[model samples]
Target chain A: MNYPIIVDVTLREGIADPEGATIERALPALGFNGISHVRAGKSFRMNIDAEDESSALAIAAALAQRLLSNPVIENATARSAAKG
Target chain B: MTRIGVVVFPGSNCEYDALGAVSALGAEAEFVWHSATHLDGFDGVILPGGFAHGDYLRPGALARFSPVMEAVAEFARAGGAVLGICNGFQVLTEAGLLPGALQKNRGLTFLCQPTTLTVESTASVLTRDAFRGQELVIPINHFSGSYTCDDETWASLVAHDQIVLRYKENPNGSRDDIAGVSNVEGNVVGLMPHPERAMSTLLGSADGRVLLESFVGAPVGAR
Candidate 1:
């Protein structure tokens, strides 16, 4: 089975992002108006193949721990469905 | 002895990792509290990446004003070795120790992958021993890793061979494929990826040893 993983790096609502702040300042001038709070982050998609759904999921979790995400700044997981 | 100092601010968790890496080379790694204002006796200083001041006012903005940063600035002015990794790189830029800023990923998400990096400069202590354009896989764990800078500085960076590391393939949409950079003096180096994460094959690739070893030109197997 193949599994999909998604990682989100956005700061929590209360968290501060200076990069986002800089981007926010430029948005109004770039013709993007009425938009508030632009936060920046990245994502990685990995298809892990295992014998079954449980195994696939386990691999995804291990990947997340070993290489796929920064545990401190991010919250990530694997999806049993392909949409993940 | 090459005394190295790792600045530890509120959100800096990688200080120990960097210390372990530096200590592997027989260099003693000292943890300097962010509030400290003096850096009088170290040969090298590294601002390992993390959310400093809780990532307030920008990644390194608040940290740039840290009392210790004054020492960092002074040390660099005297031609000292400085390496900033991930968030540390962000801080260096925020402090104007390096040019440009780290923007959000082009994909608008956080990417954590074992990315391949190309050696872009040999003149730098960070990349000197590696073959020109050598490729190494290191983990990139960040949201704001994209590097953006204007033209004049870009041209000078290219002309001076100050660009130290480049993505093997453009991953973050970093301008000019830049993954790392050095100051004009080639002593201060900052890169967006985590070389410390790839120090051993157990994690992924041991090639990081080569990259880290270039700092002191000898290997002690630390990361």
Candidate 2:
């Protein structure tokens, strides 16, 4: 069976997010209000040939941890696409 | 003559510059395509500056998986000297041959200019000829050059004397003004500056020759 998966990669807490901070800074000048703590990240979607959803999530989470996101500076989460 | 291999990824633009710089120092320099799986004839390997694999998915992230990297890893494991400059540094970190990661510059701006660096340690093949506290002027060109590592890694770096160079004045907000670093064994070194571009005073500074010469002159076997 093929299970669809999505991996979200984000900078770990305490790491600087210059791109997100820059966007947030510009938002105030653009008349947008009440927005803060912006962060930037990358997402990857894929289909895994696994027997079940749990196996699919495990495969995706491994991929995310090893390749999609660097553990040194980023955090990654993998989930079933159908759930979202 | 010492023979050096310069790994050339699909998008690498600094292979020729690295070749020229090493050749100018009387070393035989050759380009090793990223797919080559063996570095049999090279005494040292250099991963030069440039956007490898078009800097896709972050600089060096994709290129870290190239076949040549396997050979590079084996070479580094055997204590053969390996040097990574600029984008090459990013690849080293991605490959787990070095610690820390390069992030977008703090100001979110691309930087390209000369930078002054102080020699923090001469324990690595790249800086063994220079005296501690000696300064070198090199050029840096990058959009993402800020170096970040966790507190424990920072402590280990300090304790092991793995930090090889530090910017005389912080340029891109790198932690502790770090400009270059080496692995615990000191055979593998990576730096954000372009030493190959500083080969001659006519081009701005010849101090880069000091570092390159040190690399080329390292003992031929495991350290």
Which numbered prediction scores highest in DockQ against the true structure? 2
Cα-based RMSD of the predictions, in order? 16.6, 1.2
Each candidate: what lDDT?
Answer: 0.78, 0.94
Task: Give i-RMS (Å) per prediction.
Answer: 12.1, 0.6
lDDT of 2 by residue, B1-223 (tens): 9999999999999999999999999999999999999999889999998999999888999999999999999999988999999999999999999999999998898999999999999999999999999999999999889999999999999999999999998889899999999999999999999999999888999999999999999865535
Q: Candidate 2: list runs displaced more than 4 Å.
A: B221-223
* Alpha-carbon runs more than 4 Å astray in model 1: A1-84, B217-223
Q: Model 1: per-residue lDDT, tens digit, B1-223?
A: 7788899988998888888987886787799998898887777888998899887544676777788888888888877778899999988887788887776677567888988988978877688678887999988989888887767778989998889999988888788999999888788889988887887787788777776777755222211
Docking class of 2: high
The CA lDDT at A33 in model 2 is 93
Give the C-alpha lDDT of model 2. 0.94
DockQ of each: 0.02, 0.86
Encode model 1's per-residue lDDT on A1-84: one tens digit a residue.
566655334443433456677788889899999988787665556677778877877777776654443332334566555653
